[model samples]
Target: MSSNDKLPQLAAALRFSVLAYAMAYGVSAHAASEAVELNTLSVQSSVIGTSEEKDVAKYPGNRTVLSQEQLKKTAATSIDGALQHVPGVKVQDETGTGVLPNVSVRGLSGSRSERAQFLMDGVPLTLAPYGHTGQSVFPATFNTLDRIDVVRGGAAVQYGPNNVGGVINLVTKPIPNQWETQISNRISAYEDSDNLMNNLYLRSGGWLSDDFGIQFSANTLNGDSYREHSDTDVTNFDIKADWLISDSQELQAFIQRYNSDMEMPGALSPTAYEADRQQSQRLNDDYEATATRWHVKYLQDLDWGNSAQLEVLTFGHHDTRNFVWGFNTAGGHWADPAQPSTDIRNSPREFNVYGVEPKLSMSFGSQDTLTQNLILGMRYVYEDVDYRLRQTNINTGAVTVPRDWGLKTDAVAAYVSDELGFMNGRLKVTPGVRFESIHMNFEDRNSGATDSNQINEVLPGITAAYNVTDEWVAYANAQKSLRAPQIAQVRGAGDEEGEVSWNYELGARFTKGQSSFNAALFQVDYKDQLQWQSATQTFANIGETRHQGIELSGRYATQNVPGLSLGLAYTYLDATSEAEGPNKGNELPYASKHQVSWDATYDFSGYLSTLSGFYYSDAYSDNANTVEEDATGATGKIPSYMVWNFNVSKELYQQNNTTLSVDFSVNNLLDEEYYFRGVDTSPVGRYPGLGRSYNVTANLTF
Candidate 1:
């Protein structure tokens, strides 16, 4: 096709790519329906007695799936806290309430989940990834998801964009044919802190001539948390409906709204931190974020056992934040900055996002012998963002708007994946390719600066697996990922380059009798990696970095003790900067070089008990590898610490498919105190960790 002809074709195919954005959401509904018996009206785990988790897990790739049952047992306060045991992920709890998350994969940057992909029910969740590349503002609770699927490897080639880190799909509640409802209440406290939460869910079907289903859910959390002056409140609501359009067609729609208001409390200086970790530096500053999103989808089931889908999504996101506090301008070295500076400002931003996509996926050949699965799709997405900041003069009591940034971006993406199975389906190979074209326009209102950048790239990946037996599998894969420059990084015809990486992995999975485990060895090398410097507020190609690691996780049931289970997960990583710059040879911050987690559980009759432990190795606090001797909170060297949690729950009653459950748990069981993250840009960067705490919850389901 000629350049002009291809351009139109690309635009036309964008819708399919948008459908791909949601990752077969309609199919998920179909699968959930089939898995749940119509007669059973309950809020049970949708993944129970199913191989979907194992099936989604590819050989030679890094993947982890958390089901509803696991979420219940953990009763973690934050989504990041629940995922702490998963390998290849680093989560820092900035707000104790899960309102503020700084997460990373492997050793990539974690400022706002910029290096990874975040999805909810297959739909993207961030404001405008290409425009700002941050997710620090959008945080969700763990109780709202039926499951969480994480994929990290070349096989992610089908998941476009920030596929550089991995893909995180937070699956929403499924629509079942039966009627169900659930109510949950929780209260928690520390020696000096308290929390409160409530959740309600309702689902029903068959009102529209036995061919439709609808579901509604609402949940809220509020608290005066472990940190002083750090209060948080969040509310979320969702609605889903599906209709059987015809014998061969179906329709589905979903809508969700979220709102959050949180206070930062500010990080403590080294001295003040050592004196007391519960003090607040910014007492009156707060932030608010809100979003409303909706989507419509249509699905067709072809007579040949193939399927097609079309989807459209629209949303608006807004954030208003006030930062009026003193912070260390120099790096964190003392209890408080020797020369502190107060920055008083109010910043507000908004995002208007829309997307459309259509996709065709098919499977052909004998079911037990040779089967081929293919998926083709494209998507067109547009985003408009407005940002402004107003600075206040304390002495003069005047407020002046000093800056404004306007960013508009249009993106078109197309992708195809083919999976071939052989030897009675024991062996499988999948190859995929994705094409992306992006055009971004930026206007600096204060400077009268206008510039535009357009870029495109093709990403490819391959994965192969062999099932040696019913209980064992071996796999290997190699793939390349690409990331375009952020809107702020590019100038009109500037020399800034995009980011790329090649990943290679080998792994195996095994299950037998009462034990199962997954192990893998992986290495990711980057070229022209992008790093955002807070000091200068700019992005630069940091040259090169290498991330290699060994991941192992397993669980075993004691042979003699029918109700006892033990679990363990360990990760060893060599993630270091090799760009021959100021950070050369220095290990990345946050993600520990050695991470380990273990849990022991006892499940007997209606009562269950679990004990979990977490450990991290010491790491550097800054790129310069600076180290301090004092136990000061701002020591350039991050100190290693271990913490534990204990939980026990009882099913007080169960009859007629109805049940009541009560749970009690303790976090930071020993009260060991330490910090996991630090901002090296200034002295006000040392954030104290949470102290010991306890919680109790009651859940009723019918």
Candidate 2:
């Protein structure tokens, strides 16, 4: 390298040395503080659990944290709207209202968001790992989150199964030291719709006693969506309490509940869609969901320099949907494209699930120069399900032919992990392993059929990191991740096999001044790829599959324009089924080959402005690689598309702990005409993308 290059490197190294010295001194000098803040993303300790907050720089995994400030840039109404800007992540607009999003990471399937683990304050938010909606997860409301933490690789070893793709933790707002209340409301405009979107939120918290505090919140979402007959009404309630037993012990508890009801406009036929994208014929389709959750945790400081914690969580969910769908099938084919009599089905499902987990964490070191963190955990989960299906008799206009199914499941898991650091924390390594045992029983009372299955698996992971300089770091990781077999495959998972993958990744991060950059390359090899067959309603463990991708994300502050910054996130994926499969060399279904999201932000004069857009490459919807649409209303490919969005917000009040703000945003600025998803074997041919819309928000806090 040239001397000019060496000069920059030398300067960076010197700066890192000085900063390290300062941070080390601060750690030793302020040993009594609650937590030491190293950066925006990292902390010396946390209050949520036993491990506290560790240094983000020292963690070897590929992770990202979107802070509250970043979230305000767009003031997103849906999780999908916010996560769309993240590289290596896919967020599909399933219901167009953010009520139901298919979010996946690292090219994994996200049909129902079952490809990854979703957490709330580091707790599992999902129940059954099999079936269609069996493994669904929920974490309060999107507007209530203070931040989001994402780990792309090796999260399975530390968190357990269902993390093969990644882990997403929605961090909630904490209670303030003093009493406070906040109210927020929003009104939005939709395409070809007279009814406006109305949303309301209220949050309150205060210290009830010298040693106790509590936080409570309620939110509601109602009114018209972007499409006809797609109106929605949903409400959420949350309560959290924190009690301090002593200076060394603390207890925390949380409860949340929600009820949602909505009308699904259903899909538009090809002719109808071509005429007017907003047209819909299935007006009677409806969906309803209700859920409740409870959590409790206790933390103890064992004095000297060690701590331990215990935690438990349980939740129940019920989902019901009655829809008349599909265009073509063996028994029923639509002649008019708008009416399919045989496709009418009413399905109502109920799930009662509970889980408990206990974990212990220990910290050991001498003067903080060298430190080792160890964690041991055990988990138990149980779930019961009741599903009933009834078909409508078109001739008689009455319900007929009923099918009822029941299921029970149990899961046991254990894990141990260690984080070892040396060389004054310049280098660190993390090693972990997990064991899981699962049992399931299913019965079809109407058909007199029963099935039982059990499966066990072990997984391991390791990661290493080197902080070469304050401005630069390098990391590498290898991990094994697993996805539990679907309910259809569970009949013989013991003799057959579940989906598994081995992931390898290497990455680097650099930061200078107000600019930061990250780049990573990863490859995941699957042993048994579960291929879903729509015709048979079953999941088959196919041969091998490989997914490799390069992810890039960065931020740059303009030198001449203060408060102006540019951000970029891009991904390139090569996801293919192994050559041994019947569809060898073909790209995985719905796995886009390229994706890019960009943003420009300006913050000044108490006003924050943002402009953002995303582009996605065309993707196949099935393994068969069929491109032409069949007579059955199934298409082979989803076309490529791009979407643009804009937002601007300003603070109206700011004094002490009281504040108020207002913001406005527009999505699909260009009125782009496109399809979000395509299917080759499905009854519906395509799902059109969301159209242009406008949103206005007002928030108050005191």
Candidate 3:
């Protein structure tokens, strides 16, 4: 009934569930006659095809899946935080409060964000109605996600493009048959801050003869400044309903709302280091963001004996963001002559997207003949962005006029893919093509011009796989992708062009009982790549850049030992840009050459039933052409470092269904002193990596 008493009940429930699942695992044979007895607590391979093991091997590109188990064991405070464990991914912090961090894959930058797609529950997270820009930010409070899928390479043609780097898909929790709730609380000693995170989820469906179902979830996260001025409070609510219209059809709808306000620590300089990590906090700077999303999806089994299915989905989102900040001098002093003025901005955006896809498959030869499958789809999206900016000069006490602008974009695309299975399904080949078009219109309320531009592209992909045996598979693929020019470029304010990317890859997967491994070697080529020159604060067209690398990943879980798991991944990248411009044939700015990640976990079968693990990452940079710092080394070369972590959960009360977990983590475990990027000639440093810190967390689930 009370907050203190809730966690124990949840812990009991989790204990009971884990006991039941473990019992089932022991009694039920892996070669059972019926299904594996799926339940909420059972972990399944979430890859595309069947089990997670097969899922890893079925892809022709590099991919990683962060299971709920893994998500719970790490300090995944944001989308970037959740993905930092994956190889080839680097999270950059432009703001201290985790509000505006930039996520980059391989060696790409933010300007080419369109090359990567972000998704929530299989839907594009883009505020761009057409879903072309492929950009979206998830709230740091979205810690309730079920899983996240990170796919690498241009293999994203299956989900639609701008996917040169691939796609990041965040899957929400599914409706469970019973009531559930959780509360996660954590405090920081250094910053003297605490966070209370809570979630309540409910599901009911079988009452209608298993034909209908409904689910709802509500979550809240409240916290104060972890440092001097970093603070955030956010809330989100989601609801979903499913109706089995008949044996051949189903209808589903979902809605979600998120709101939050976060403090802005602004950027810091090297001279501010004496203030210490926890004591150094900024003031009078903050940003607020809100979003509402809705979706409806319908699936129908074709009349042709359920050999085919048609799916139609519609999605919409409304988002608003506001930011306010002012310049501050060092040493907590405001009387500096060089300090700048205050700035304020508001951005509002709306997006609507819909699509329909039909797929058909035919079998032959009694599990031996060649099988054929085809998928046809069409999608349309539209979005509008409006922004207003106002500023004032604090030093001169001068007022600045307000400026407003709105940009509208529309997109349409059609695609078809065919899959052929030969040699008794041992050899699978898939070929797909997409034709897409985009149009952008920009209007400036106080400007003298309204500008518009249109562009079209045809892209193709081919993948082939050979099943060397039931436990092994080898595959190769080639894909093409393109990113449309930004709407600002159409206004003639910048020199920007559409970017085209080509990706070629070869990979293999091996599954041996409880152990699985997957690896991919790829070369990504870009033409007319976009790069920015900080000296002039302008954009330029770099002729070409290449990202070539090999990715290796493996996992092993043993039932014989019961509750022990191990996983490892490594990515080696040689990213370089060749251009006729000033920095020709130089290493692409900020692209790291090597990355590694490894984790090991063991669960004790005693009453405590403890789980513990560790993780590490190598060093990387923020610029492609390392020219900033020539004093120690090249300009963009960020020093490398590693970190470690541990977590444990125990069951307290079984009858009440309660579980409790305590986590201890150390980031930058070695106190690695390094900056992501900084100026060698000046005293100012940009984006210093957080120093070593320890965090203890407690979570109660029922």
Stretches of candidate 1 off by over 4 Å are 1-52, 56-60, 194-209, 304-341, 367-370, 400-402, 492-495, 531-539, 558-560, 629-635, 679-683
Q: Estimate each model's TM-score.
A: 0.87, 0.87, 0.81
Identify the runs in model 2 with alpha carbons over 4 angstroms from their true place: 1-56, 129-139, 304-337, 367-370, 397-403, 492-496, 512-514, 532-539, 558-561, 631-633, 678-683
For residues 83-116, what per-residue lDDT tens digits would candidate 2 score against the true structure? 8877888876756667766787877877667776
Instruction: Estimate candidate 2's alpha-carbon lDDT, on a 0 to 1 scale.
Output: 0.69
lDDT of 3 by residue, 1-702 (tens): 122443464355345434433332322122211112222111111114321323565565667778776776554545556676787776654433344556677877743244456767777776562423634335334455778888875354556656777777777776554555566655433322343222222222222346666766666655543355656667777777777665555667888888877665543443453344333223445667788888776555442321444556667677776656553433333312124434332333433333333322222222356565566666666566665565556556665546666666667677776676788778978788888787767677777467666768888988888899888889888888777665444454443456788888898888787688888898889886665666766456665888888888888988887777787778888877666756566666556677777666776663222222223333334334443443322233455655444445454444565666666554445555545542111112334555544555666766
lDDT of each: 0.68, 0.69, 0.58
- The residue-by-residue lDDT of candidate 1 on 1-702, one tens digit each, is 122533454465454444454454434323222222222211112111122365444344667777676665664766777777778787766667667667788878777677878877666776675666677467456667788877776545556677777777788767655677777777778755444433333333323457788888887877777877777788888788888755545677887788887777766656666777887755535677877778776665432343233333333344433333343224543224334444456667777666776666556665456676667776677767777777665556566777687777778888877778888778988888888888877778888887777778787888888889888888888888777777556654444556888888899988776577889899989877866767766666776988999989998886799778888999998988889767887887665799998888888675798888788788876666777633444547778888898888999999996889999888889998887544322234467676788888888877
Clashes of 3: 26
Q: Under the 3 Å rule for N, CA and C atoms, how many clashes does model 1 have?
A: 22
Candidate 1 has an lDDT of: 0.68
Locate the minimum summed-lDDT window of 10 residues in model 3: 38-47
Give the C-alpha lDDT of model 3: 0.58
